[model samples]
Target: MRVAVTGSTGRLGSALVAALADAPFTGPRGPVAWTRADLDLDAPAGVVQALDRDRPEVVVHAAAWTDVDGCAREPELALRRNGEATGTLAAACAERGIDLLVVSTNEVFGGDREDHTGYAPSDPTAPPNAYGRSKLAGEQAATDAFERAGAMGSASLGIARTAWLFGPPGRDFPHKILDAAARALAEGQPLRAVDDEWGTPTYAADVADAIVELLAEDALAGVHHLVNGGIATRATWAEDVLGRLSIDAPVEPVPGTTWARASVPPRWGVLAATPLPSGEPMRSWQAAMADYA
Candidate 1:
């Protein structure tokens, strides 16, 4: 199948490209087109036009305005990328009878929820911050497009929500933490991290693999949570990452309130997938972190 992956330049998108490079459906004879350009989220109309011209069998929508704090500061840009862009892609896919897979976020759930363990697919969505709100809007827009295009066929939309993604060649939490640790060690400064915030850390490679599996499975439609199996606070995660990297930086535990951020981060928004026919759950965050380190 000819697949078009948006945001092919991002960490997760790049990983997906690597995974698909050797995929059975994308070998020397198989069909695959990996693009990091032309489908820019900033130009939704241009993206739709490109998709219409390419007429790919599947469209993986991965581009988005992911800066959480930046989203809070600039909601208009967030809505444009996360919300309007989704609708445009979904509509384009619906018109061509192509499968549209939208990569979403765990932040859609209000972080204020008391249950920090994790969120389920059925859980209610109440975004606590602007980022979450924008993502939720994107989800709704995709769903609405699917509903309006019911005449096309059965469920052409797939929402794969993940969290705390980290890997090589991308600006992610693990890289940032390790960079900070190295700087602190070099400057003889102490590294401080928030112990209050909690969530699952997903590896970009694992997530890319899961997306391929989901696309191949016929029964894997609708909303699904895709993340690493385990959960941990930022402090614990930082310490584990440092330990794995053989770094001896002392990470000080600090509360979320102590950070004094402008927006209230979700105390907990970890997620668990609702079981797939492949019977494979996401790898544990610890295991993923080890590989990432």
Candidate 2:
């Protein structure tokens, strides 16, 4: 099957492109990478025109305004880019009968609960911040589009929600931790991290692989939590990365309140994975990090 991925150069997008190339199910056509220059979400006309030009069997919408703090500062722009743009894409895809899989976030769940377990796909959503709300809007928009097209249960629409995603080609959480370790070592201070904020640190390549498996198994519809096996607090995750790098810099555990940001993330952003095509648990973040390091 021919597949195209938006946000071709992004952390997860780039990984998806690579995974698609190696995936046997992609067939001889391989994968097409659509950058923003090719199809900007801000311009619905261009999106529709581009979709018509490319005409891939499947479109994986990976582009988004992922700057959480920036989204908080400009909620309207976030809604326009992350929410309304998604609706535009979903509508176009549904009209053309093209399968669409939207990459979403676990932040859609309000982490107000003081529980240790992860959120399932069927859990009630109550996003606490603008970024989460915007993403949730995108999810709803996709669902609405499919339903309007009389294809709600056709398995042609999908939402792949992931959490704490980290990988190469960008300054993700693990990269920041490594940078902080270097800075702390030079300044003679310990790296401070939030212990209360717990999440599963997912690897981008792994998520891409899972997404491919879902498509191959014809299980792309509905919500799927494609996260790592285990959960870790910010401090513990930082410690693991530092240890893997052989950096002896001490890490100080602190509450989430101590590390303030413009946007408020779900303290419990962990997402429980559903049964994968392989019928095995996703790899642990530790093992993925080992390969990354």
Candidate 3:
């Protein structure tokens, strides 16, 4: 199949690209890697033109305005870039009879829920912050486009929502915690983490693998949640990382409100994975972190 991946240079996107190359359905051309220069979301009108040119059988839309705090500060820009731009791409794909899978976030749910088991794919969405609101809008737009495109022969639309992605050697949470632990030990202070906030810490590689498997199975329609099997708060996740590294520096737990940020992340952003092709949930974050470490 002729597959195309957007945000190909990013952490998760890079993993997806690598997975596709190793996938059974990968064509001789492999996956088309598109950076912002190739398909800028800022210019929505050119989306269809690009789609026509690439003529990809499947387009995995991973590009987004990922700066949560920045999105909170400039909500309108967030909506334009993440929401409206996605709608344009979805409409374009629908018209061309191309299957599309949009990468989404756990933040789409209002995190204020008392339940901790994790949100299901069919749960009602109620975003608590600006970034979540924008992503939810994108999801709605994509669904709307699919509905409008009557009798889309082989076309399918999938939404894969993930949470607290951490992977790639020096760019994510584990590395950040290591750095913070080093600093805290040197300064004789404890590393502080938010205990009140809870979510799954998913490995990018795992999510990418799951996505490739999903595509191979032709299960690209409806909402899917791809996350690690278990859940953890920021503090517990940090402790796990530190324990794996044998770091002895103490990690202090604090409320989410202790550190003020422009955006509010979902407190309980955990998402239960939909039944995967193998009929098994993804491995636990601890196991994934071990490989990453």
Candidate 4:
């Protein structure tokens, strides 16, 4: 089971490498190979070439254009990375009869709903922002590739949609909040955060572990929400991080409108989780955060 992982330098990608390094299941017979530079989002042809060369049993697609506001500003770039690249990679894997596990996002559901409940895998998708639209396009492209490949060389595609991931090797929301708190404390100023936006804050390691589990499962196909179990607002998450850091800086809770950001923030709760057919829940966000601190 030689596995080829893209975006080896990203937050989740790095964690996936580390997880596979320590995983007992990934032995000599099932080695995990990582490619960061040679096969990147900009070079889809290179990605296809790498897949052909490696002929890996599984290809974990993690590279993407993740900047929400940037996606809104430059949709063409987003489409190139998130949409076109994904389609190309899926086609490549399909041609070689290699399984592909695509890492997706909860943003596919426009966070405009009033309710803050968890979104199931079957929920209707209505992406409000350009980033979500591009990710949704990637998902559709992967599915289409599998369909086009037919029964002969089609690969098994699993779209794992996650949310609010944070961890080492990259900047995430928790790290950002902690850094802002530290800066505020050093400057003797108050930290302000948006209290309205709500979602699950997942740890990258946990998401990586879930991906490994999903890969090992036999009947795990189609779309699945792989987020932590709990939900919290941005302000609450900020306060929690501050508390973990032993910083008492006053975290001012402000509405989302106060931020005045370029991109349209998802107002409705974006936190989501779903049990696999195996009846196992994803890792807990609290435990993942504890590891972060």
lDDT order of candidates, top first: 2, 3, 1, 4
> Alpha carbon lDDT of residue 179, candidate 1?
90
Given candidate 1, what's the lDDT at residue 85?
Answer: 82
* lDDT score for candidate 1 against the true structure: 0.80
| Candidate 3, 141-246: lDDT as tens digits | 8888877986255599999999999987346888888899999999999999999988989999999999998899998888999999887989999999999878
Query: What is the lDDT of every predicted structure here?
Result: 0.80, 0.89, 0.89, 0.79
How well is each residue in 1-112 modelled by candidate 4, as lDDT tens digits? 5777788778888888777666666666444555655567887877766766667888788888888899999988897889988998888888778888899888888786
Which sections of candidate 3 miss by over 4 Å?
151-153
User: Model 1 clash pairs?
Assistant: none
Q: Residue 26 lDDT in model 1?
A: 54
In the predicted model 4, the residue pairs found to clash are none
In candidate 4, stretches whose alpha carbon ends up further than 4 angstroms from where it belongs are: 29-32, 151-154, 269-271
Q: For model 1, where is the 10-residue window of minimal lDDT?
A: 27-36
Itemize residue pairs with steric clashes in candidate 2.
none
Over the stretch 2-120, how does candidate 2's per-residue lDDT look in tens digits?
89899989999999999999988887778989999766867755778778888888999999999999999999999988999999989888888899999999999998776677899
lDDT of 1 by residue, 1-293 (tens): 66777888787888887777667775464334445366666777776667667767887788888888889888888888899888887877776688888899988988777745578888888988888888889988888887788823644788999988888676678778989998898999889999988888888899888888876775446888888888888999999988887889999998988866656667887886667658978778888776766
Candidate 3 local lDDT, residue 79: 97
